[model samples]
Target: MTDISTSDVQHLAQLSSLQLDDHEVEALRVDLGNILGYIDQLSELNTEGVEPTYQVTDLQNVWRDDVIDNYDLGRDELLALAPDADSNQIKVPKVL
Candidate 1:
């Protein structure tokens, strides 16, 4: 089993900005130790001949050419649709 000290748990809580009580701190100390022990057990597994798996779904991204379709609307025609327009640009009320 991993040895997780009280100070270690307290330090972790401080780093995470957590306000843990004494009971919660103690509980987390044990849990953290158990997690580390499990990781240690996994480190002992034989994976010398195993291949690393990246994507399990075997799916790939289907990409299409980016074609701009303006629907036959010219710049002036689109600007005319806006409530306000000046200097070939749409104008709106100040947001801030």
Candidate 2:
């Protein structure tokens, strides 16, 4: 098991822009050491034949053909449904 010093915890807290109290610092010291020890245990596993995968779902880029439908609504009718319209186009509030 790895031992994390209080100074190491303080340095990590500083890098992460965290303000930890005395009790929190001691708690994190033990937590970080346990995390590193778990990682050390994982390193001992045999993974020589394992294939690297970016996603576990095994799905690739799926695409479909574009089809346009009028949906029984004309351009003028769609524009009229909008709360605001100008010059035969829908007017939306400016975001910027």
Candidate 3:
């Protein structure tokens, strides 16, 4: 079993930029200890000839040729449809 200390939890929280209260710190210490213990248990397994599995699903990426299509509309014609335009650019209300 792994022994996780209070300082270990505090150091982890500091590195992660998390402001944990005392109660939460205690909770996380136990949780981290349990996780490490489970990992230790897994390390005891023996598999001499087992093949390592990278991905379970036999999925492959499908690719398609890139095609560009414009609906026959000119730049100036599209700009004219906008409610507000200035210097060949559409104007929108300021955000934030």
Candidate 4:
């Protein structure tokens, strides 16, 4: 069994910025310990010369052709509906 304790779980929660009650912390400790134990057991397996699998799905080039969407909208007509405008142009406060 993993040597995980309630204090360890509390410390982990603190590090992760999680707020947990005493009961929640206790449950998390047991759950996390089980997970850690499982990982430790897997680590004992001989993986020498075994190919590491990054993803199970086959790799493919899923791409789309580049295209321009040209909508001929008049600049003056669009600018006219603005809440504020200056000299045939839409004006807003400088962001920077």
Candidate 5:
């Protein structure tokens, strides 16, 4: 079992640029110790003969055939749909 000292907690706070009070530092020391202990426990588990998994499910590329369909429409026909138009051109409000 590893022990987390108050100084270690303070150093961590300094590294993270955190302003920790006395109570907060004490709480952080205990929390960090518990996290380290859990990680140590995980280190003891046997991982021999185990394949490192990259993905859980079968990876498949889902793709569809690209098809292009052109609609036959004149410039005047498109300009008529706009709310505002100027001399055969559609005009909108200035963005900026």
Candidate 6:
């Protein structure tokens, strides 16, 4: 079993910028000890030949060939539709 002392709790509180009261320090000492004991128990597990899994879901990438579109309107026809047009291009207001 882990033995978390009052001094250890105080030190941790200082490092974390916490101002713990006497009661809070005592309470955390017991709680931290219990947490460490539980973690120590997990160290007894045996997994000698288990494969490491990165992801649990069975997913694959679905890809398709890229295709270029040829709309009926040419550059000149598109520029005519714009509110303002410059030399073979649409004009927009300048932003800072």
RMSD of each: 11.4, 10.4, 9.7, 10.1, 13.4, 15.2
lDDT to native, each model: 0.93, 0.91, 0.92, 0.86, 0.88, 0.88
Model 6, 9-90: lDDT tens per residue? 9999999999999999999999999999889986788868988788878876756568766557678887899999989878
Q: Where does model 4 exceed 4 Å of error?
A: 14-17, 65-96
Model 4 worst lDDT window (10 residues): 62-71
lDDT of 1 at 82: 92
Clashing pairs in 1: none
lDDT leader? 1
Number of the candidate with higher lDDT, 2 or 3: 3
Error of 6 at 95 (Å): 44
Clashing pairs in 6: none
Name the TM-score of candidate 1.
0.45
Residue 73 displacement in candidate 3 (angstroms): 22
Ranking by TM-score: 4, 2, 3, 1, 6, 5
Task: Kindly indicate the candidate among 3 and 5 with the higher lDDT.
Answer: 3
- Ten contiguous residues with the weakest lDDT in model 5: 62-71
How does residue 75 of candidate 4 score in lDDT?
77
Q: What is the lDDT of residue 9 in candidate 3?
A: 97
Please give, for residues 1-96, the per-residue lDDT of candidate 4 as tens digits: 587888899899999999999999988988888889888978778999999988777867767668755467777878889999989877899989
* Model 3 bad stretches (over 4 Å): 14-17, 47-51, 60-96
Clash count, candidate 2 = 0
lDDT, residue 25, candidate 4: 92
Shift of residue 5 alpha carbon in model 4, Å = 2.9
Tens digit of per-residue lDDT, candidate 1, span 21-93: 9999999999999999888987878999899998889679977689998889899998999999999999999
Number of the top TM-score candidate:
4
